[model samples]
Target: MISYEEVQKHVSADDCWVIIKGRVYDVTNFIALHPGGRQAILSHAGKEVTELFSMLHPSDALENLPPEACLGLVDPNTVPAQENVLTESDLQRRAAREIMPPAQSMMLLRDFEEWAQRVLSETAWAYYRSASDEEHTFMENQDAFRRYFFRPRVLVRDMSTGSTETTFMGIETSMPVFISPAAMAKLGHPLGEVNLTRAAGDWDIVQAISSNASCSVDEIFEASSEDQPLIFQLYLNKDRSQSETLIRKVEKLGARAIMFTVDTSWDSKRTLDSRAKAPTSADASSATVATLPVNRAISGYQDRNLTWDDIAFIRKNTKLPIIVKGIQSLEDVEMCVSHGVEGVVISNHGGRQADYAPAPIDILYEIRALRPELFEKTEIMIDGGIRCGADVVKAIALGAKAVGLGRPFLYANGTHGEEGVRRVMEILHEEITNTMRNIGANTIEQLKPEMVGPAGPWVGANRPPYIKQ
Candidate 1:
């Protein structure tokens, strides 16, 4: 058994040892390799960091650390009580328990978000909420949805026949919505991606699991039934072989599709997440901070050399339908078509990758205007700031075969576990049903372009004519 004193002796940067759940981890070699950065783990070196570690990481994260890193368990008699070790998480957990509403009362997607922010630890909240530098594109994603106005048809006959049911990439779904892939679900709940996949299966929807999911792909697949459709998102590493192995594994596991992400060549400067990692007060500059908490998955195995040739390699290697996510340029969409990609998820990495990037909906509009015929060939999808049912409707009307919702589902899982996710799907289903009736559409196919038009602040606004000053 290890002792606190033994752990303390290794606190310097060169030989850091951290205590997590009464066990010691020699993270000296791992500090620089940590995705969150070195200081995040270093700050908790030699401390009883079980609670902090649980809050910020998944169960598998500890397992992923080198086996040799596990020095030994600390003697329980010598350590403080488990309750004392969990002081921070205990407080947050209690607050969450106090504020959470009954599942039935959560009527809208935004309600889940409000509850999640209230209950999640401050750092977790910041990590989930933070966007790229200046956050302009993040704001734009939500605002762009509001700019489009829907034209509701009056005196519709046989509204009961309206169906929200649709198929995405030939996978039957209750609605035209799918869960967009996001990383680190453990920050929301212990079950993490397990909870998400289970909820998606229960509701007959698709879930695109992130490569950096707190839970591994095998674990997530185990939680799901054989018939449940799953998609896998990938971030290519420096080693092409690693990506190839992952592709082969997911295909073997029956993942219906592969979303090859390409927008993030470099990590973003997310101020809120960085500030969350900083010492609480300016005077506490000397405080131990084991990690420099950057946005999770912002800067990791992403290959800078990712290009069309790699895409071709992936396509040739896997029979699974390939969807190129984060396509914003007309040229890229044209290229995707030329390469015969099965699909394209028009996205900007939820505005997490780049500042001032065009919102996915705006990009969808541009693509529709330029090459409407491409939508017929490729299964087009969009995700970013899709908060409610109307947003989904707008995307479908604008030629998206499906609309992906990321943050709402994550917040749902955070606020109330698996049940929260179930409620979110239920809410979206209701909203979509209501919206289809209002728009006089009986099916997803009935949602035509003429049913929506530009609205709100930018309706008729254009660049002001410049005069010589």
Candidate 2:
């Protein structure tokens, strides 16, 4: 049996070891190759990481570890008794789990969000809810959906013919809506991305696995059943070789598409997240606890110089269809089309990257107007503040091939695990069906440009400045 003293001695980049469930693992070689990056592993090097490791990894994850990496068990007598530290976050987690509303009773997506906020720790809530800078654009994303009014036709016959069934990037889906890639789902639930994969399989929707997901890509895929459609969202790393390796792995694992996120070259300034860590009178008793930094900023080999050249490298590396996510302008769309990309996800990182970034919905209209032929050639997707079924219809009418929902699913997973996720999709399914009935559309194809109107002359403050009234 190994001693804890021996493990503690090797805690640097060159030689790092960790204790997991009484077993020691020499992760020196695995550090740089880690999907979440080296720091994530290095932070807990030489320390007991059973709790965090179990929460983030699958049940069989350790079995895949290299045989040589396992350096035997720690002596029960020499190992110190595991401390059962109950901090405020622990209390909040328990409280959140205790207060989860029955999945059957959750009627709306907003219901899950409300309960998730109550249960999540202050730091997690801040990170999930916080937007960049003043959050003007963040609020605008939701409001953009409301700005467009629906022109419903009266006395529509054969409403039963309507169906939300559609295909995205040649992948059949129950509805036009799909789950967007969001990171570190373990912050909300222990199941993390596994919950997302299970729910997507249950409901026949596409699941875009984030590169930054708490669960490894293999773990998420392992939980999925055959015929369940999955895609990968990639953040190009500074190390080109590492990026190439990741792409090949995902391709081999059967990801139908790759969404290369190009917007987040620089990190956004999340002030509320900073405040949650700062000392405050509201939680003076737990100031020391909060100082432990519950939420770590997403860091890794982020390439600030990621450009079109890297796109060429990715195309040559894998045959998976490439979708350039985070496209905000006509110029970028043209560039993506010029590069022969299969699709484009018109997004702004859900308005998390910049304060005044243009809404994806607005950009969607601009793209349709400028390059109408490109829509026929390239599949267009949009995501940002899509809170309801009518919003889904509006996006389709405006020219988006499909829509993505990120934060809502995160809240769903936190509130009710896999069932919560299924319920959120169920809620959207109902809303989309009801919306189709009311709008007099029979099939997704019938949701044409004529069914929607301009935001002009609207009598709401949320309306854009260009729109009157």
Candidate 3:
């Protein structure tokens, strides 16, 4: 058994050793291959990293390392007791949590975001809230939804039996809204994506598991019921064999579909996240200001050469339905249909990848106007800037099969864990039903394009003439 003193001697980047859950590992060789960057591991070299490791990775993540890396267990007696010193941010977060409103008081989806901003750490808040560059697309995403107005058919019929139930890629769901895949959920809460899984299973809604999730596929699946449908969102690895292994693993684990994210060929400039100090550093001002942003650090291994031809590679590996996510333009949507893609999520990566990318709602409008037939050719879904149940109703009216949400759920889960997520779902379900009832639609099929129209005369312009003045 290695002593704690022995571990401390090998702390340099050239020779790194760390203790994870009492087991010692010499991770010198694996540092270069680490997807989250070498600095992420080097920061805590020669230290016990159980707490930090558990936050960002599953228990079995170290299994991927070579056998030689396992230098056996460290002597428990030799290890010193860890100090429980809290930072100023930690004190502020704790203080905020004490005075925060109860979960039931959060009636709206945006309400959760307001609380999350107050409770989350600077790094976590920045990571979830930041958008690319000037965040033009980010702000525009929500603004675009305001461009349309619902035309309610009053006194048509007494509608108390309206249902939000719908099928996504042939799987039945409680509502048209599904939780969109987001990375590193543990940053928000300790249980992370597992909180989402259990909540989704309980509520009978779909949950798309992220490739960069803090929980393992086995853990997320185990948290779900046997028949609960789950989708796997993939970021293709540069090493083809690694992705192949992952595809086979998820298929065996009962993932019903694969959402291949295709927009992020390279990382974008998220100024907020970049400006926030890295959590791994003790002295953020000196140690981490110049380090890579969280997005780039975790996404380094994602294949930058990803193309349309790579779709075939995924098709050959699994029988699961392929849904191309991050389709931004009509031409790309047509290409997806031609390729026989089972579905497509019209998204701009939640406005986190491209600075000025068009909002998903606007793209949905373009598709409806130009190639309406494509709606029937493949399942059309949308995400980005969706905040309320009315937004869900509007998207359905414009031909979206279902809607997906990322940041709202992230904020909800961040603030209140599983209960926060369930509350958001509950609020959305109520909102969708209310909107449907008011609009004289009793079923998902009744929502039509005619029910919605462009808002006023200044529909597509950046701002109204009066605002410019």
Could you give the C-alpha RMSD of every candidate to the true structure, in order shown?
A: 4.7, 4.2, 4.0
Ranking by lDDT: 3, 2, 1
Candidate 2 TM-score to native: 0.86
Sort by TM-score, top down from the best = 3, 1, 2
Which candidate has the top score in TM-score? 3
Worst lDDT window (10 residues) for model 1? 460-469
Off by over 4 Å in 3: 75-83, 278-291, 457-469
Name model 2 segments beyond 4 Å from true: 5-17, 25-46, 57-70, 85-93, 277-297, 369-371, 456-469
Q: What is the lDDT of residue 420 in candidate 3?
A: 95
| Model 3 RMSD vs true structure | 4.0
lDDT values, one for every candidate:
0.82, 0.83, 0.90
Over the full model, what C-alpha lDDT does candidate 2 score relative to the true structure? 0.83
Lowest lDDT 10-residue stretch of candidate 3 = 460-469
TM per candidate: 0.90, 0.86, 0.93
Q: What residue pairs clash in candidate 3, if any at all?
A: none
Put down candidate 3 lDDT per residue, 1-469, tens digits, no spaces: 9999999999988999999989999999999988788888887899999987887787678888999999999999999999989999899989999998887899899999999999998778999998999999999999999988887898877696768888889899999989999998999999899999999998889999999998888999999997999999999999999999999999999999999999999879887997774444566565642556779888978999988999999999999999999999999999999999999999998899989999999989878766789999999999999999999999999899999999998998899999999999999999999999899898898898877757865345622222223
lDDT string, candidate 2, 231-348, tens digits:
9999888888988999999999999999999988887766666676666887688554343232233555577888887788899999999999998887888899889999999888
